[model samples]
Target: MGRFEGKVCIVTGGASGIGAKTAEMFVEQGGCVVVTDVNDAAGEKLVGDIGASKAAYLHLDVTDPDACQAGVDLAVEKFGSVDYLLNSAVKMAPGMLKDLSLADWNTMVNIGLTGSFLMTQAVGNWLIENERPGSVVMMSSIGGRQPYGMSGAYSTVKAAVKMLADHFGIEWGGYNIRVNSIVAGHIETPLTAYLKDPEIKRGRSEVTPLGRVGQPVDIANAVLFLFSDEADYVTATALNVDGGITRSVMNHMPGRKWS
Candidate 1:
């Protein structure tokens, strides 16, 4: 039997990129998935491709608290219960701290941080009321840990997300709820599609210990492990799925091979 044979997962931002890949993985592993995203066309197409038995699409704006709760309601109404939540919705607004506007910062935080919190709360509450064990996986970025001058708002919100996972994990442990964050590295997704340039791609690969950028499947696989019973004991941890880019700082020195 598949690892997630009897599971039901709610995946935010499931229209594309890592979220889409993760939702696909969940269904492949025998789970029913409620795929939520702002992109109705892509989301609906994904549900059609995955089949109605295994997947359903919901038009969700994660920043809206009511919408987040409604997503949980939809999942329960269709799939019976919510077993997992993948909070992957994000808004990437890259800007240096000095020039970053308050509006951009708020937008980023509202989507990335507050949106995640709302979803988590909604799902967490459902699990608690149902007396079920569950897991939550948040999508964070390498920028959250390292100082990325060009991604001030993104980095700030991601960092907060990491801590938010820790806080939720601690508070929800008594209820058998696991919360964790995935610190993604340079992955080739819609979000990072611009890095397709040879120079940029090569530069990224040179710095990563794995010698290449990550694919959506890589992050999806990691999330699957966390969602399954295999990670029953894991919680409040930030797993880095970034090809060791975060640890290869020395490789970027002026005369180093990577440089």
Candidate 2:
């Protein structure tokens, strides 16, 4: 039997990138999933690929609290009950703080940080009301724990997600709910496809003790573990799935010499 056999899951941003891969993994593992995103075309196509009987698509805007709650309701409505929630939707606007507009800052904060909280709050509430114990896997970043220039808003909001995960992990312990974040490094997802230079991307990878950049599946594997019954005792932590990228902050200086 698959790890997620007889499970029900909701995957936000399931249209593409890491979210898409995670949704695929869940379904492949025998989980029935509701794949949600604002990208109607892509989301529907993914549902089709996963098989409508095994998966369904929903249009979602995670930043909206009502919408967030509604998405959870829909998941339970469709699949009986939600056993796992994966908050993977994000907006990464690259810019410096001084150069960024208030709009840009709010956009990142709302979409990345606030959105995760709302989803957790909404879903956690549902689980509580139904007396169901569930697991949540939030998508955090190496940027959240580390400081990087030219990644102003993205970095700031990611950091906020880490804290949110900690807070939810503690507060929801009574509910038998596990909340955690994945501090992912340079994963080759469509989201980071814009960084096309080999030198630029390779430099990020070379510092990793693993000697490679992360793949979406790497992050998905971590998510699978956190959501599984095997990790019933684990909660409220930001696990680094960065191929050891965060192992040495000092690697930065030495890595610069290679440039």
Pick by TM-score: which candidate is best? 1
- For candidate 2, write residues 1-259 as lDDT tens digits: 9989889989888899889999999999999999989999999999999999889898999988888878888887888888899999987777888898888888888888888889888889999898989999998888878777887588878888888988999999999999998999889888888446788678877888788788889999999999999899999999999988787767666434645
Local distance difference test, per candidate? 0.93, 0.88
Could you tell me the TM-score of candidate 1? Answer: 0.96
Candidate 2 backbone overlaps, count:
0
lDDT of 1 by residue, 157-250 (tens): 8899999999999999999999999999999988898788989999888889999999999999999988888899999999999999888877
Candidate 2 lDDT: 0.88
Off by over 4 Å in 2: 252-259
Record all residue pairs in model 1 with backbone atoms less than 3 Å apart, i.e. clashing: none
The candidate scoring highest on lDDT is 1
